[model samples]
Target: MGYKLSRRQFGQLVLAGTVVSGFSYLTNKALAQTPNLNIVGIGSTSIPTDPTAIPEVKTTESYSTHQSSVTTDIPPVGLELVLRSFTTGSTQVIADNGTPLLEPNEILSGFTSLRDGTLVVAITPLITSRRKATPNRLTFLGASSAKTLIVSGLNENQQLGSLLGTNDGRLIGLVGSKNGVPPITLVDINLKTGAISPLSQITIPKDKRVSNLAECPDGKFYTSLLGFHGETSLVQLGSNQEKPIVLAQLKVDGQEWNNGLQNLVCSGTGQLLAFGAMRYQTPNAVYSIDKKSGNMTRLENFDVTQIALVPG
Candidate 1:
């Protein structure tokens, strides 16, 4: 059977420096001066246990911060979710009245925020134990409450990908194979029922995979396609366009970025931001992308897997 960590026990693990060490808080000088930009990210720490079994929670401990009294209730078997906020030169966990807005035994698959500042997250089971089955869920975390709804329409083999909230009040998501293959279809997610409706099928080269998705203020959808050998391309997607257009190959300075870029978020002011994953001994960093040129400017150095712009 699976085990759940109490709020206090979770705090002890974090206080022991086991949970937060995987994430780095290094901020670039350019981002330190930007007081107006605020970003929220979802990060994970993997605790290696028996891959075929879930571990039992042993101890209980508590953690406190000046901002809020922190308590965590996630299981300690596979991936522990961390919800973080990034500002000028610091990163901190987001809490609500002594409780964190997180779920247990789940991995963050996709993230997005609505125009009214409502945050939506897509999660799937960690699947640490072979004997137990865990259902996929969608959580709507708002100012006063958090509601998790069971995802019904996805097949057992299908997996949820990046999520985007459009200007017209629709929630869009990418649904694709669990192994991250091609034929990633665009789907509309019902915020009320967690039902998925097919929008359009996205076609990409077999050599590449879609890593992240974003929608600009102008209503155009964009996605990052990562190649097998560290090559990355930014492509534009639309129903009106005959085919996807390659905007630019992502590069920093004059060279292609070998470290892959994941989580893509378009800020309210029209700035495209992404978290660059660690690769080939290079550290993780946050960058702002030039939509037209596909050039990236380093904003900060932080190891975050997924990022969403904090709605103002």
Candidate 2:
């Protein structure tokens, strides 16, 4: 339930519900279309952004605003899917033991899973609009209603957005800067013991803030693409001794760049999926990225409101 992002970075997109301008710019791409990966033509994705309407795939399009984000996945319980909304809403969880836990005025932002399959939800407690000074809260929910996460003291600062769990179940939150200047700083948290630590301490590169976070199957640090000016680049967390590596660069390809990666989450297994669209454009279609090949391909028949990864 802990997060890396301080309140400063979390200001950009509040959950998947309220999306802002385009983020992530590719390094370069005069020629489009990458090779050596699989490319299957799925249908098309359409958002309500344009006056003209069409299918979701096949035609390169644009998108803005998403209703939810896919953060983490626990095999049998479904991907840790989150629904977004400008207003506060509540959801109920029925633990395996059939204990009822009521979550109120909460924003379901991100998720992370432990090595043993326990799930940690990166959530910010819902405060009434009247309560503007409320600090963000992180809670841990066990896979079997073990117990929710508990943190001692929280300063009014520090808002968290996306989250990714380590192979050993350590939680990392994409933090926002609370003070002046550009927001969005990366930070990590230990869910098991509620420890707050700086991810940058582990050698993560800083710059051009992260819009989303997802773990690759290889047990790499983690990856999330950034977009701006019609271009995109996939940034990954590297070893403590190295810098954050840009796996798939932000480059323009034949006038097309993969812009705006909305929600990204990886199954403890090898599957990585993200939903987004062309830069500066309401919701786009879902995309399945090949973590191994740096391939951003389309995935059809996804429920934007609820996306869960089912092992094949």
TM-score per prediction, in order, is 0.71, 0.53
Q: Each prediction's Cα lDDT score?
A: 0.60, 0.42
For model 2, the superposed segments whose C-alpha errors exceed 4 Å read 1-106, 125-129, 132-135, 150-155, 178-185, 249-259, 267-271, 277-285, 290-295, 304-312
Off by over 4 Å in 1: 1-35, 46-105, 126-129, 201-208, 281-283
Clashing pairs in 1: 8-61, 9-61
Which digits, one per residue and each the tens of the lDDT, describe model 1 over residues 26-94?
A: 254534433345555555544434465443332211111111211333444333434333422333332
Encode model 2's per-residue lDDT on 1-312: one tens digit a residue: 312222233231122222111111111131122211111111111233444533223213123322222232111111121222111223221112222122323334555445543444454543334334333545443322445554323444445656666655566767653321234566766555555666664444454545566665676655554544435566666675677777675322234445655466564344555665655443455555654456666543232321222111
- The CA-based lDDT of model 2 is what? 0.42
Lowest lDDT sum, 10 consecutive residues, model 1, at 60-69
With candidate 1 superimposed using the best TM-score fit, by how many Å does residue 157's alpha carbon deviate from the native?
A: 1.6
TM-score of 2: 0.53
Clashes of each: 2, 41
